[model samples]
Target: MSDLPPNHHADLRHSGPSGYISGLTMIVGRGNDARLVADLADLQPGDHVLDIGCGPGTAVRNAARAGIRVTGIDPSEPMLREARLLTRLRRPAGEVEWAQAGVEDLPLPDASVRVCWSLASVHHWPDLEAGLTEVRRVMTAGGVFLALERRSPVGATGTASHGWTADQAAAFAHMLTEHGFVSTDVSNHDMGRRKVVVVTGRT
Candidate 1:
């Protein structure tokens, strides 16, 4: 009934409750295996973080371990429930805030956060521009935004079964630059059998 395509629902619910544990385990698992620390960049102690599309609070936990206040926003109630549980398990009672909201409709106040990190969720974004603008509005003047997304197929390893293309990554880079993030940088490389682009910018 929704005018959106069939994949729209799946994509829209990318961070939803169903299979959320597996999803978080897969991506954050990879980050952890590689010892991939966050791109805190210039963030200082006491800075607030907004983890868009935060799946199961991995990034939220990571930021909190660094002494930062973290707020995670996702469209899935199920995912938020897990986030809440994780926060309570590992952090103090009020250490983190988990909100059920989409990237294009974050519930936090404007300029309320010092950093925003979105990982492995860009391809699912319905309106990339609106999502980027929403992130920009919520970031402080010197805040940082780091987005890590899957890139086009460079070889057999980089190729998704659906055959992702480089053109998609390029379009996303243009979108990021147009939304006022300075020093936008996009990099692509082989991650085992997949290509990934790490996009970093400053608000």
Candidate 2:
């Protein structure tokens, strides 16, 4: 059996319209992960950024605070609702756009984003290849894709149902390379029980 924790959004029937809120709150309550993305993306003000699988707009709000034009996309309308609610809480500093969509079929123009990041949401993708392909298509040349995916064998259990295997990372790197991304770095970073691989690609 898979060792990953149950997805909070597994049942949307009773999840209400703010399912994204629960998921986002669970994934990123404060701004810790946003700081991680900031450090990885080295973002500057006015940069157009995309936060794929952006739960509750944590990264979106954080990026917006830095004067970055942030757009968040997710498949859950409930999540988007929470993101909208979260956006309402921002102090009208920067701009934030929200889209109810997924990485594989994003509602964004091609080669239009400066930074694209996904935190702790890669494993839920039904088609990682298609999702990454869409990511590549929407990123401008030299744009950054910081995908922090959970890796297997993170804890004493020696198995992670929620995390991807080492081979999976290599395959993702290869796919990114095939899609015209260069300088791909795929390695695991220990995050307590989760080993996240920060994949950066230059297109």
Candidate 3:
């Protein structure tokens, strides 16, 4: 058995019409995480970014607005539809595309992306190892990968327990290092009504 920590919400698959509602609600209170991810990426104008589990394309569009090529992929059709509609209506300049995919399977060429990020989504991955291997495969030499989760209180329950505690963040950082990522780090930040932990590493 793998020694990795459990994915807190492995069975949570946001799909179907209810996913639309999730997407709409997702638009709220996520700007901080999205903007923070984009900032942490240190993106160049023409760089390519892949956002795994990119619900509603919030982070995708945030990166795209900086004149970069960005693809937002999610497993849910309804979420992708909502993302597409939102993108078309509030179009940000630069290349923006949406794909229906999950973390375990990415539809991009090998070593084709400079940055890969998952915001508030990694915990939902059914298989973290496969997801990380796929991420490492698609990233170019010297690429960056980041995963951000809300910093939840220990022993919390229900919706409040959806995020990671400090220990969980550290565990994720260690896993990142084990996956051949260099300079892995974990940090805590206060993002306005939500405290979050971010794990970053360079490949």
Cα TM-score per model: 0.77, 0.81, 0.95
Worst 10 residues of 2 by lDDT: 5-14
| Cα lDDT tens digits for candidate 1, 1-203 | 12222112234454335546545554454454122326535557778888887767777777677677888887777677777776677884325878888888889889998778776666566667678889999989977887766554434231141222455555556677789977676666565765566667787
Which pairs of residues clash in candidate 2, taking residues 3 or more apart in a chain or in different chains? 20-78, 20-79
Superposed on all Cα atoms, the candidates' RMSDs to the truth, in angstroms, are 5.3, 4.4, 2.2
State model 3's lDDT. 0.87
lDDT of candidate 1? 0.65
lDDT, residue 109, model 3? 93
Count clashes in each candidate, considering only residues at least 3 apart in sequence or on different chains: 2, 2, 0
Backbone clash tally (model 1): 2
Error (Å) of candidate 2 at residue 200 is 1.6
Worst 10 residues of 3 by lDDT: 1-10
lDDT of 3 by residue, 1-203 (tens): 22335377898888777888888988988888989988888998779999999999899988888788999999999889989998999898889988999888999999999999998888888998999889988999899999999888777778887788788788888888888897898888896688988999898
Which pairs clash inside model 1?
157-193, 158-193
Q: Which candidate achieves the best lDDT against the true structure?
A: 3
Q: Single out the weakest 10-residue window by summed lDDT for candidate 1.
A: 1-10
**Candidate 2 has what TM-score?**
0.81
How does model 2 fare in lDDT?
0.71
